[model samples]
Target chain A: MTALSALIRRDIRIALRVGGGALIGVLFFLTVTVLMPFAVGPDLALLTRLGPAILWLGALLASLLTLDRLFMADHEDGSLDLIVMSRTPLELACAAKALAHWLAAGLPLIVATPVLGLLLNLDGTATLAVALTLLAGTPALTFTGMIGAALAVTLHRGGLLLAVLVLPLSIPVLIFGVAASQAAITGPLSFGTPFSILCALSLVSFVVGPFAAAASLRHGLD
Target chain B: MSLIDLANPTRFLALTARVLPWLAGATAILLLIGLYQSAMAPDDYQQGATVKIMFIHVPNAWLSMFVWGIMSVASLGTLVWRHPLADVAAKTAAPIGAAFTFLALVTGSLWGRPMWGTYWEWDARLTSVLILFLMYLGLIALWRAVEDPSRAARAAAVLTLVGAINIPIIKFSVDWWNTLHQPASVIRMGGPTLDNAFLIPLLVMAIAFSLLFITLHLAAMRNEILRRRVRSLQMMQANQKAA
Candidate 1:
């Protein structure tokens, strides 16, 4: 537990350090959210109706953009080899790194959600709904995305391929996140149904992501 | 012969050499029969002749998923059993699977325009199939992006398994999302509601298409094995020159 915690802390610190990956995700999220209303037209009603979707998409893409680096940095620096050779199982190490990534990168997107939400003309409740769904959904994105990150780590240029590889895997998360948020915003349907499913997806990815990532890392580095 | 015997690329090549011509012959004959049946089959009173598109569309749709299923099994062979020809099977299947998926989507869209009055709808079935197509493209891209064949095979195997698990979840979520937004307006085109006249041609066509996939997959696998041999031989020649 201490080792995992330390690994998480080290990752979080690295991500928060100068020229790090954490905050840039939020900026990308902000840019995406801000760009939506321009391409979509500035009608307030339209923006409000579209708010949840825009926020969810922004969060998805923002997290995906940052995910390509999840393992690449460690792989390049040779720490990934050491980590693989360590007593702590590679799967646990992967989960810890993902946790740190979510804390540094994903959490910030959710934090910035309400701010982006306002720009999209969403009211308080709607904004909260989007934020809440994002909170539930983004972990799944980061974790499943970690699998892509691991697979692509050995490649010299993997950024665009990473997105292509991960986005389809992220589709269910996007579906449920947007669905739950839209339900909260306006619904004849109950929010708990999709929200619960969204949570279930996150939990499933949490289990599957680490093992898959570890397996790929083992195969990749050798 | 057992799977182990076929694992040897040379044996596999010889087997395919003999089997492929027969497979191709069978596929051609089946396709002709199926096409003839589809042509003579009575058109639906409601959809008129546009209904004939089902004879083409439904088979591709079925094969789109079926081909992925085949790849996923071959992926298991690669990652678990580490079968020699398994990667070749998985790798070659990707493009064929992708092509079938493309055909499925295009035919479905063409069939949709006259029937649904639109080329596309965000219907659950359509959306899930679109996601499948994307996954196929992603798998193909992953294969091409990786330079090493063995490493690429393992990586692609992991992805294929991950995709197998996700496809069901994606389908369920899309269904939920679609239903939540609005109830399905049209009766599902390829359901049990298909009549005997339609069903017969559909089955024949489905079988014929599966044969086509098998024949192509075997031939492609043969080509891939030969290509790898050529690559290894070229590398050996380069090494000899360097010496």
Candidate 2:
């Protein structure tokens, strides 16, 4: 198999075998969504209004949970070294890892967002927007996330540090993600504006983030 | 010969020491002038004496970013050319950057209270600057957290370069969004809109702050090099004793 396919498959198998990381992330999202409505009371209108932001925030926090694991395990067991030694370029390897991460953590949260969105009293448009934005923007979370994971690979306790380091950088994602979702519910903004910006951000991340991660991994290896 | 020769730490140290006094003097002189001008500058017609806060606030904010840019370039040097001094330069700049960031935040809040009727607002420029401060703190903390100095330097260098992305976002957030913060007055498409009196003092403060940053960075780099030497000497002595 090609390196890309092989890497992707390996990650999928690993993700399935472990099972808990993605589950925990989605469960965290659900828990936050579930608990927030209780705190805000039965004001379904308020809930609906906040639905997109709540969903986006949940997704942000969820993705943050899985970030430390992205590189730490491979780094610890020396698998990272082997991967670095592989003929495939580090950027490709980074993409594979980020892609797997999105599939594993981001995709699950996205799939489960509708159920959570409904709990928040979202209408069909908001629900669809929340799901679609998460679908498009989660890749960005994973992509830019690679840079954070790569930087923190050598640290002993990187979980909290990774969140601190990555969260601020992810603000643009949060801004556009929530804006896109909210725009979907509100008046005249077609999906094209925020959606296109989100996609552009994702594309920029997909291209630049991998190369930066590659550089970081090389630095870590040294 | 001069270029290649300075690669020697000893020569670099000697040259820096020789230059330090002059840089320090210039910084001191500029700061004196900046403070005097800023203190005497007339109050804004709209803002009253509170406008004076801009002198310190703007300079500190500019240096906060200026120091980060310096760190980013130094980091690139460290990562790309493996310049031994570059890591020292980057590491040394982090805390100074953090200090400038803190000063900017505090002064900005102070300025905001008198002008905006509140101490804090989630204005784009403020929010981004606050984030920049956090990034500086994180980088400095990361540097101190790692046990091995070399490894820590590399980690912090990577983090600095990555965090450079935030600078533009902070600068442009006001322009891109409907931020509460006022748009560019000093740096618009046409020209600076401020009166000459305020503009001159602001520029002087900026130059003064840049000099201050340079002086501090040079001092910090010299101290870091000395610290590293001391650490190596201590390690060698321990090894000899063990032998």
Chain A alone, TM-score per model: 0.98, 0.95
Winning candidate number (lDDT): 1
lDDT, candidate 1, equals 0.86
Give the per-residue lDDT digits (tens) of candidate 1, residues A1-222.
998999999999988764476877876786677556446554557878998998888899999999988999998889999999999999999999999999999999988887567556677888888889989999999999999999998665579999999999999999999999989879967899999999999999999999999998998786
lDDT of 2 by residue, A87-167 (tens): 999899989988988888789998898767655767677889889998889888888888888888855558888888889
Model 1, range B118-148, lDDT digits (tens) per residue?
4544556765776787688778767875667
Candidate 2 lDDT over B74-190, as tens digits, reads 899788988888898899999999899989878877777654444544445655676687678667657765656788878888898888875686457534542333332221111
True contacts kept of each: 0.00, 0.00
Model 1 clash tally, residue pairs: 0
Q: Mark the regions of model 1 whose C-alpha exceeds 4 Å error after superposition.
A: A1-222, B185-187, B190-193
- Worst lDDT window (10 residues) for model 1 chain B? B181-190
* Cα deviation of B199, candidate 2, in Å: 1.8
Name the best candidate (by TM-score). Answer: 1
All-Cα superposition RMSD per candidate: 15.1, 15.7
